[model samples]
Target: MSTYMAFVYGILYLLFTTFTFVFEDAYGFTQSNVGLVYIGIGVGMLLGLAVLGSASDKIAIGMAKSHNNGVIKPEYRLPALVPGGFFVPVGLFLYGWAAEKHVQWAVPLLGTLLVGIGIIVSFMCVQTYLVDAFTVHAASAIAANTVLRSVFGAVLPLAGLKMYSKLGLGWGNSLLGFLALAMCVVPFFFVRYGERIRTNPRFQVKL
Candidate 1:
């Protein structure tokens, strides 16, 4: 899951690294205005965090109640990934193509909003799931996740210029969108197999 988040975040940051130049070159915005253009994304991120924060707890608690043991597995925190996975890819495509086509600047801004929403939703889910799954070692799990996320976050953006330069924003981001589409399967995989993996002796042996 951390691996999944790493790539998703890296892909999102591609826009983070590139959008300022996009606004200037495509939308004819000055430096000061570029910051203002990001407000849509900021709002979208907050909205996602707010909605998912409440929704995730509700879902986990509801599922826990349904369990005969009255215990919630970490996987219960993952259903939100279903929607989150969808949002990232769709948002990427929307923003990428809108910017590439030079449609109304607002169109791309709307796309950025979706991207922000997807990113925050996914981020929260991953963090919560890790914390639950590794209760005694939650800090270690989170530290590992954070380290990998940071590595990818720092490294992937470095590729942004070459990627956008060669593939153009549309296809470059489409490549990321497709990668995100592939990652959508990860949550389901974890949900179905997580308990087994956690309990498996060989798995623990490997660890």
Candidate 2:
């Protein structure tokens, strides 16, 4: 779950920084105003972390307790992830097509809203699942995931500008959006069978 969340957010960090200007130009906003548009997503992300991040832990705990079979089903943590997974690509498509046609500013902004909310929800889901799954080694799991995701995050951003420029906003982001859509299935699969995966004796031991 944490791994899935990391990859999703890794894509988001790439999209937000890369695509904001693309939308802004569509709306005919100045560079500074475009910066502000991304600020909205920034503000949204901060608010989401504050409110939903810890709530996911509480929700997970309740679901885990309800299992009553002495085993905490990891799938319980996946519900919140569903919304995030759906919204990320939806937002990307909306933002991409809107910018391509130069639609109303709000159209692209709506896409940003979906993206911001999705990222936060997914981030919380991933973090909480990791904490519960590897209680004793949660920090280490997070550290490792963070390192790899960061490399992708860094490399993707560098390439994003060139991609958007060459393909144009619609195709470039749509291509990325499709990739996100494919990755969205990962959490669902994990949720359905994560218990079985974790049951392996190898996973029982902490790294």
**Best-fitting candidate, scored by lDDT:** 1
Looking at model 1, the pairs that clash are: none
Cα RMSD for predicted model 2: 2.7
Model 1 deviation from native, Cα RMSD in Å? 1.7
Stretches of candidate 1 off by over 4 Å are 205-207
**What C-alpha lDDT do the candidate models reach, one value each?**
0.87, 0.73
* Steric clash pairs (candidate 2): none
lDDT computed for candidate 1 = 0.87
C-alpha lDDT (0 to 100) for residue 34 of candidate 1: 88
lDDT of 1 by residue, 1-207 (tens): 999999877876777888788899999999988888778778889989899988998898888899836778898989898878778888889888999999999988888888789889889999999998888789999999999999998999999999999999899889988988999999989988988887888756334
Model 2 lDDT per residue over 62-152, tens place: 8767775545555677777765677778888888788788887788777777777778777777766777777788899888777877777
In candidate 1, how many clashes are counted? 0
